[model samples]
Target: MAGVFGLAEGEVKTGLRRAARLVLDTLYPPHCLACDAAVLEPGTLCGACWVGAAFQTGLSCDKCAAPLPGDPAEAPVLCDDCLRVARPWSHGRAALLYGGTGRQLVLALKYGDRHDIACPAGRWLARQAAPLCRADTLVLPVPLHRARLFHRRYNQSALLALALARELDRPALPDLLLRTRRTGIQDGLSRAARFENQQGAIAPRPRRARRIEGRHVLLVDDVMTSGATLAAAAEACFAAGADDVDVIVLARVLREE
Candidate 1:
């Protein structure tokens, strides 16, 4: 009888806890971080918001992942900006444009500490890279400065890399590269200024580069604005003996019209 009473008490406690959680979830229901509409579950945006934020398909530039303005069947070509300034990496791609709901989602994941959002974002990135995921490739996230890591207590790029690694069954090396210097924010800077700001900013830690040598690497970042940061990272990876480096991001900022 004592054992029976204990089991009953355990069931009662479990029920109470579940009821409490339901009440809490209802009162402060998790909403879409992008559109602010109530979501069916946490870490997810509503369908409208998802549609609004997803990258447009059909025709995109092969090199930089920019949507071809009109014709869906056109061959891939660089946009005017890419034509003027040569990109440093082999190629680049992103999951969305940098405005509307997409930018807010990125901020929510980074600043709001919505790490769970990374699964969906990373799945989207994998789908984008589906045609290109090579068996021999290595996944690496862009590094944050030690100072920023201490302040934020987490790296969004690392979260994204973990997600991609799980979905693709690939190895995600979070510490393969290091950002040794913290520079000014790259926004509002000219192309040359952006380049100068990132020069010599990244280095491959000798201890971490053992597995990276002669590997095909895929560098991940949340956004690509000027391609300067990634360029710096790829340069470091190559210097550390990576045979080739390609890049993927959650978004790419096109030149404003």
Candidate 2:
């Protein structure tokens, strides 16, 4: 019957699906994932929420992604923190500042089971991580302790890393890194305490060492506060013989000035 309009069965089915989708969208319009405000499309934020998200823009620190306070055309600038300490990773990038809408987005994805937010967050991370992506680069996520993994039922870092791998066409090695020991929560921990808690917590899987040897690794994470976790993970990758390691995160905890 549909052949009368020159529409093949597959084409007719596709059209019907589109029509159904349109009707459904009209009935229950898409809402912002973070604020629940009505939006034109799903998996997005409303204008106010979008404006609140403090995304990192031009002229950032070369190693920490903190907004630099000098001329944009100046040589690669390092933040005071980066200059004070030698980081294990060669560089780092983050998409947003960890406050306001950014904080809401992270909390939603981290605790609310809003995995859908990973799509846009991962895309943003991919763009920020573009300078680190290369043919020989391998994407890896910060591993969660087995106990924590069991409790949470999923590793948010792994989710973001997998999404980034798809966007960059790179291989994601989630198992290459392992959390050998569980660490206490990082919340409210001082810088030195955070480092101590994460120390020796992450290690490369011995059986998968060959996969990381001599390759550039990109470490993906949900957020960077004091960066102690990423530092520990990058150190493990370096110990595993990775040529270099770079870090990328969905958000960076902005220090109060």
Candidate 3:
């Protein structure tokens, strides 16, 4: 069953690229993403950075994914904030705690075009989102209005969604969710202002509405500050006949009180 140039089962197949790989490994092997220290292998971060990484832990609020201050084993561990004001989406999950290294990494991926960083971060998001009951998931990133899209040249939410979908082995539905109206910048807005500004700011594409029906949609965004934008998008998805809607974000900024 062997071909004319058949080689043995354990034979060394030589090539110029293999030789180049050897040279490359010796000169510049893989390094940690957080720090420049050499790592034992590719796709791994240094021990110190990995240990220091602020991973999301403990039971989170059922609605907002904010960590609750109680034993995780207890059911109904909703945070006080969630009890006060219900979120639009069923629930949400985030891979890392906001601020510190997590915040810096997100900024780098967003503005620096360091897309390679997505691999590690996206993998973490996929793991965090696995507990949801619905497996037939469709990922939808919060869209930037056309005007902002043109100015930014790309949407950070869309990039995060794409990376997340790939990690979760789900289809990312970017075009299905559309932001037809341009809203004011949310950075400096108060919580009330953020909600008011984002009102009527997002709508599902008419033609694409049929495709989302009866599906579990996961909305992805880079950050959740006031949670207004996510709420608006979830409302639109529900209006379009989506069976359920959940959200996943890179970070959730705790309100300054």
Q: Write the per-residue lDDT of candidate 3 for residues 80-116, one digit (tens) a residue.
A: 8778887888888877767776776678777777666
Relative to the unseen true structure, what is the C-alpha lDDT of residue 114 in candidate 2, on a scale of 0 to 100? 88
lDDT of each: 0.81, 0.88, 0.79
Pairs in steric clash, model 3? none
Best of the candidates, lDDT: 2
Clashing residue pairs in candidate 2 are none
What TM-score number comes out for model 2? 0.90
Ranking by TM-score: 2, 3, 1
- lDDT string for model 2 (176-209, tens) is 8999998979987788889999999999998998
> lDDT (0-100) at residue 96 of candidate 3?
72
Q: Which stretches of candidate 3 lie over 4 Å from their true place?
A: 1-28, 41-44
Comparing 1 with 3 on lDDT, the higher-scoring candidate is 1
Which structure is stronger by TM-score: 1 or 2? 2
Task: Report how far off residue 180 is in candidate 1 (Å).
Answer: 1.8
Q: What is the TM-score of each candidate against the true structure?
A: 0.83, 0.90, 0.85
